[model samples]
Target: MADASHTSYLPPILIFCAGAVIAVPLFRRLGQSAVLGYLAAGIAIGPSVLALVNDPDAIRGTAEIGVVLLLFLVGLELQPSRLYSMRKDILGAGLAQMALSATAIGLVGWKFGLSVGGAIAVGLALALSATSIALQVLEERGDGSETYGRRTFSILLFQDISIAPALALLPLLATTGAQNHSGAPALAGLGLALLAVALLVLVGRYLLNPFFRILASTGAKDVMTAAALLIVLGAAMLMERVGLSMAMGAFLAGVLLADSHFRHELEADIEPFRGVLLGLFFMAVGMSLDLQLVFDNALLLALAAPLLVAFKIVVAATILRVSCSSSTEAIRAGALLSPAGEFAFVLLPLGAALGLLNTQQAALATSLAALSMLIGPVAAKLIDLWLSRRAGPAETMEEDFEGAGGSVMVIGFGRFGQVVTQALLLQHIPVTIIDSNVERIRSASKFGFRIYYGDGTRLDVLRAAGAGKAKIICICIDNREAALRIVEMARAEFPSARLHVRAYDRVHAIELMKADVDFQMRETFESALGFGRVTLESLGLSYDEASLVIDSVRDRDAQRMEIQYHEGIAAGIQKVPRVSPEPLVQPKAKSKALTEETREVIEDGGAEVAVGGVGEPER
Candidate 1:
């Protein structure tokens, strides 16, 4: 017979999984975030509602490991070079926001009858935005590479790095924490914590790679995954034993391996565990909320949650605006990041332990954080409404590709795409053109062309437009990033279709080649070469001679690109012969010429010429 304790645990596990699976999708479908879903699910199953789980404490210890894993992943991504490159944004905007917000919030907390230490804890706790939720939302919207997205990420990253010192500060801030207990024991613990950090750095630098290599050679993926967890937990346990937060240790371990060869593999191995545990952490926090306390103080909380969100949004927007971001960008960052995050769950308890806050205060703060998180999605919706107004009717128009299918599917209907469609039409080949710009579609329709409204970066739109059946996919979008995304999606989802892309530049062309595209050409490459050939003809060369010059230049360029693709972009620079840096057409004289290209002044008649130079040619 199985142990009774073991059997009793099954129901809660089943309930937790079911709650997450159902609630997350439902919330997402409603245009809400997944973080909100997890919290609501926790509330439904906790004693506050269904009473399926009477004790949230049972899961809190386990859920905290999720944070440890989160920090590890964060550290893995912050390679030294990347960190250095982003130091300005991280330290400037990120650091400044944290300092200012904490100071502002701390003042408020202090004014409300809290002790100095309690105010400090509350200030820092509330100042942190949820890194997981904000980043996930940005990725979902496909804006992680945008300017505002990058700035948001930088601020969130700095918040994450702040966790270590914040955790360490809690104990010292406690009424009878480190200082009251200061003796041989405290000294020993401090020494041990330092020793643990040193040990972790040494193991990660000298031993971890070789250890993973052996595990890999055994050809058992499970063993490699097990090893990754061991390293994460081992470091965490060491830190916990030495009076430091587990998250601190895990972060150190990850930083050690950030530049290691196995960095990606470690991430791939740990991601599943990180994702599930992180979800579990949020749910656990939700379950821990004292719904009775919230009900009792409903009036206070009702005022506080929205006020907190509004203040945070105002603070964040102010900081971003000063950093030269546009109003839309500032508001978006403010709305998405204006929430007290997972750190509050950790810091509040620590604050309680250190006599900074009582149990009721801690619970109240937790309730406030949860309520603020709930308001975040609604705030995001409002920002969308605001941005849509500014986006103009042409671009903000909805996508409708009904009955839009053809043998050849073109992703964009801009200048390049319009010309490409004409050539395809010249061959009597039926083609379907899709673009996100409604105004462009209207203009094309007037020209006897039928272009549907769609975004190629979206797979569903591509499918609805009949890309699955099309023999070829032409990515002609002016946005290089969007075109690359389509190329990747086509390779994965429409493997049967040949991909031909309009590269934005040489770098874009190389990236397409690396993505294994069937054909790609720089948008201006051939046209520019043709123009130069005609230019040479006008300068006195025969057509054949001009063609030879163009051919030679094209050949040299192709060779340079080949070198760039095989080696590096800098390697291609060696192919260009060094020459004098003076204008070839203006050896020793200044000449008066057209500063601007002349356009027609009369219908079907050229503009009258004005020549003031000694070398002016006869008209």
Candidate 2:
């Protein structure tokens, strides 16, 4: 009884979703980027291949919204204060990148026999890098807070901001007088664009926060989410109606809300939508690729794509090297940002409309850009390998730490790790620490701590941090999954090293215990127990009496935890009768087959006493 028109729309959605579900996980498992997988999925199900989605235009329209939301989220992450702090980099490096890359590409286009206007259009389109892809890649590598990432983001921000003016300028490049409007109209259009932006900012600053607060007070999360969507879509629509990029408008709105009290709430509401749509956006890019054109001009497409990427990489690397003073950072910035961006689709069409590019030229440009993006990750990997080799084995953490063996290896140098490191240092005990966060490592170094940079879950990184020589390996990372992984890796690779893991909760503690970890401290257990002791003392109990009571409770809890570890709770509880008179204590004598490390820590403390795990490891 459903309308046939409505039912017909289901197949494409199903095909797209099915492709994503199948391809993303497989590609991730193969150690490839998920964006690449989404693109491959789109190509597989597209008209050129399976013909599952015959009309690419319809999907493109929907996918464009994804780009808008992506920009909006980027704006949300970039607070005004942060943007201001990086203004020098944004203006200096970002401007230089655009000017230099555009000029170079424009000359290339002119050499290929295009008009000056056409060459300029092509250059501008190719100068920008894919913001979505670059950000996603940075996030995957956990480098979003690193200096290279910040520099990359500064350039991308300038590109996004430039899109509006770029679109406006395209029409003026037309040779035909009818299409080419006079300077007055162009100025008027610029004024209108500015007004629209000002209006968005004003409304967002004054009206949006209060509106969201009211919606949030209703205690309906779905309603709050709906309001957030309404704000984005409404701003996008407003911008489109006024002849501006929807993404630009959405970004303005996002910036306005970035410093609001409800920023996190709004972000949480919008994330799922952004992710799904962004996936679809990448898939749409894949579907839009003209396979026949690529096949017919395979050699030209291949050469053009790599040439564009190469030129951009060199320009970016040189700029970063001059500014940052580090070749590794420079190479990373260049390689990661070499791809032609999503804006090329917008710019190329505008160029065609303004008589700068013919249909054939536009198609060629589009194909070349897509190919460049497809090879982006591979290019980045090659650059990283090259840089690492150039830096030499002596510069690596493994080599640096080889002569500085320590008794303790701290897996994370965050707040928790910092505390442990300080404590050991105060006692004149040697300690080696590693953290994956580049920013944290740099900050710790300023404080005179010699923390290394590497992921501890990798056995190789662990070995580099002197895990083999360490008597104790402390797993102090705050992330539950990461903590679990470190525990597993440490236990397997360094069976001789005792692992002291920080668990997030009772469930986490149980999981760590199940892994046969030498020690597992629930993050808040000792803190809560300490608070209880303070309350008892305040209530007039003697210090000795309070201590006895706390110790008794702690002992009983440990016994319960141990019981729950080997047997299910029901079975463990059944082992203890209600008629029992004696206190429950883990037998002091060695059990039948206790692990040597576990027995040692327990014997040394008289109980498995550990400090609170509530705060971050110190850096």
Candidate 3:
């Protein structure tokens, strides 16, 4: 009997597995988003389609756990300090997105004949962009930590948090408050929610680390995985108890463990489950989408989904603009978050229960939410395509590297590259020079230089530039990102060639070192040090004295770069001082006279540097 009971589930499991295996790879090959694949798969196998899996609600409960796990993993990535830095985006941009999106959408709902309360409920529900889908897209593109990614995430986080309030607000919005719906219940629920968060924080701070420590001592990998799930589910359950989303609870749990030593272990344990379940969640959402309702109200949905998406885009883009985002960021974010989020499923039903919306209105709203999610990925893709078209293509010149493959291949013709080529030529070594700049190439040819025109970032260009035959490749591009892109490409394309790169700054130097290049030097580093040495010599110091000071500073900088390579720039600030602590002369014997110029440098010693490298963020 037990064997038979378990055997009955295999058919559905097999179907789900088959759908994913066939559809996911196909969608990927077709250059479509995997989220779209899962959704398509779900709709195909759902009750509304082939009817292989008749009850979407059955699987939805389990698939939702994927969302919880995803949030927990997201939390692990954010340190408290990083989250704190996004406070403005969370409150300013996030709040503005909600207000404007809801208002615009609400007006549309009112025009469609919904009661004022129903329209407000509808607007609020649709305003919340699908967190699961947006996060999945960001994760796929590896943009979660980027400014645009962070900004989008901030709004999503705020939306997740606002669900509880939206729920409480529903009763108040209802024209008929039969159950004596009042502010007291809302205030009480808020208190309980706060208390739950406090409890989670307390457990995270005092108990989780010690518990994990005890668990780790047992050498039980399986138990650690179990514990990871336990914490995620436990956090989710707690938040659900207070009418908050389980995903939000998991996120809070993750943030609590962010500073813990076990974070990586927990993350590693949770990753596999997160991926599978997230896929399942996407599929379940597709299955849950009522295609019949969509067909029943075809014209209504057709107008609603696109108009609603447009409203959301306008509101989000406008908010991002006001919040000081770049035009590109604002545009991407507006489109990225235009889809109605999963919370609509929860809120629309709750509104109906509170009499804020009738059954028909609730169903229509739910259908609209799901339809927006289906359209979200498509919308984002279209926006990207449009942006790409607007930006146009980069200029390129014809590649010709005949009779090339010299001992050294120099891959830039900028000021930095020109200087590097001069040094190589000074050594009497034959060099193959390449640059994609048409004007630069034209000018170099006029100067009797054989500078081949080619984009260093392209693999074919590198091969044509004699990268395969060259013993050394010198990358001296001014763009930090381009430099890194070339570094990765050259390393992969020409493993035999030793790479020497010109980095932009300390951050670039660190990245280049991390890439394991044979040699990397900051373009400004030596020049700046030389300038300082000369300035010291000019200010009443002997050449030897100035040289000694320069050497010490260079030594300190070397130590700082070593630390930055290991633990980022923040960890290097105190370890490596800009100036040596020891006086030029022994303090015990004679007090050394410090110049006013030297003292000024000492006063402004340490400063926080940008991660973008060379005065701009690479992202």
Candidate 4:
């Protein structure tokens, strides 16, 4: 009987793994978020459906690890400098979002007959949005660097930070006779919490690094992996013992390691675990969702979920509208952040345990939160559709390009092309900007910038932009194949126009060079070089010395490109040579102060090392 009991537990594990393996890929192929797939899988196999898993508590206990690791990974990304750089967004936007959403939701709850404290706890919990869902959606849409993405992330970061306080406040809000505690005890608990946090920070700053260093020297991959898990688990245990959330401790540990040399290695070791565990956590949430309660209160559930989501959306959009310049961006932020977060699962239960919420109320809130998550991606899609409809007229306004002609024709006015156009315009140089993005063109016009809307790859658009008369044509589009095609067309037709192409990478650069464009720049090459120069300066090099080093490196790199170009041709690569244009800028005089070793390092494509003196070249 004991053997049979142990064997019966295996089915649930098998069912969960199999469900994830099948569901995630299917959802991804359908262009839906993988997170939805996990949730669906859980609901399908859970008690509400097939009831494949008999013991949800057992699975949930294990799934909690996922949340811990997820927080840790998030902490790793939040480097102190990066956080400081976005302080306005995090502290300002984040705080305002939490406060406003909580108060608004709290008032609504109070109207529904909840006690003030209970209402406030619920409001605070619902105020937070899902970080994992928002980030995954933004990344998939390739908008993580856009204005909306930044605003959404700032709000999410603040929500993550607020989790600790929210967890702490739940017990105080509880009015249960058994759970009553004095004000003095609460103050003592607060002090102990602060001390625990300080201890974590102190250990992370001084002790954790050396501990990992010793483990790293052992040079065993498994050993290192073990140590990484040990640290995370140890920190988690420490926090649990101190009456704080384990996830918070894990996040603090992650932040401490954010600047460490072993950060990438730690991330690699921990990523797979985090992914699987987080998936399990989502599934556990799905299993816990009582479908019978949802069915019984169908009308209430339907109304409550939408109302909650709409309230949050209004709060988020209003905040963005006040803080940002674009209405479309505000709308996007609202849609992206409307969903209830994973932490809601944690908060609702804690509320129930502390008697801040009865079991029935907690069940209602859980179903509502789950339903909101289901609506998140769909809301984002609808928002996109609305934006597209709003921008329809702007897309058809390309007739304005008929009279547009200049000495410089700039194609694809994205982030890169915008910079080039702004610089030229600032110098009082006449240029025509062309882009296919209707919204961008419309927005630029609002800012008093003249932008022509058209597809630059079409020859008609090029002719319309006066490519024949233009002395310089800058192709700053992101598509490598499209950039090459435009280069070929311009060479075939307007050979007199000097073509400058932006390459996505080294291979793209080689392709452009072979296509015989007059000039080619690897998109991020200069920016990376600039970053390296900044690093040298931070390490105590004078500005002039850093500048000299960058110049030397740049010259050597240019020479290498030239060699690669000829070598490819010699190796029977296709050639598309154009009439060579005159050099735009003369090279600066070479420095003669470098010793032989330094020159060898430069030529050999190695970094310069300071030997005896600070900022001095190596011997």
lDDT of 1 by residue, 75-176 (tens): 877777557657888998899889988898889888987888888988999888888778778866656757788788889889988988888777666634
lDDT of 3 by residue, 1-619 (tens): 9999999889988887898888889988977778888888888888778888986566666456666776677677666544565678888888888988888788888997988888888889999998777887876665554578879999987886676578657755663444555567666767888899899999999999899889989999889878877887899899989966687788787788776766655665666566577777777777777788889999989987888788788889888887788888888888889889776876787788777788888988887887887787888888877887899853445567788889999988899999989988889899999876777888888988888876676566677667889999999888676677677667755789888888886667776776678887777666766776678779877665566566556665666667655575444333332222232233133225656655454444421132234855432
Which ranges of candidate 2 are over 4 A from the true structure? 175-181, 388-619
* TM-score to native of every candidate shown: 0.68, 0.65, 0.68, 0.64
lDDT of 2 at 244: 71
Worst 10 residues of 2 by lDDT: 577-586
Q: Which stretches of candidate 1 lie over 4 Å from their true place?
A: 25-30, 79-86, 174-195, 198-202, 205-210, 252-275, 389-619
lDDT of 2 by residue, 180-248 (tens): 456676567678877888888888878887998898789998897777678788888888777777876
**Top candidate by lDDT:** 4
What TM-score, to 2 decimals, does candidate 2 have? 0.65
Q: How accurate is candidate 4 locally (lDDT)?
A: 0.77
Worst 10 residues of 4 by lDDT: 578-587
**Each candidate's lDDT (Cα)?**
0.76, 0.76, 0.76, 0.77
lDDT of 1 at 36: 82
lDDT of 1: 0.76
Task: Kindly report which residue stretches of model 4 are placed more than 4 angstroms away from their true locations once superposed.
Answer: 1-9, 175-180, 272-274, 388-619
**Overall local distance difference test of candidate 3:** 0.76
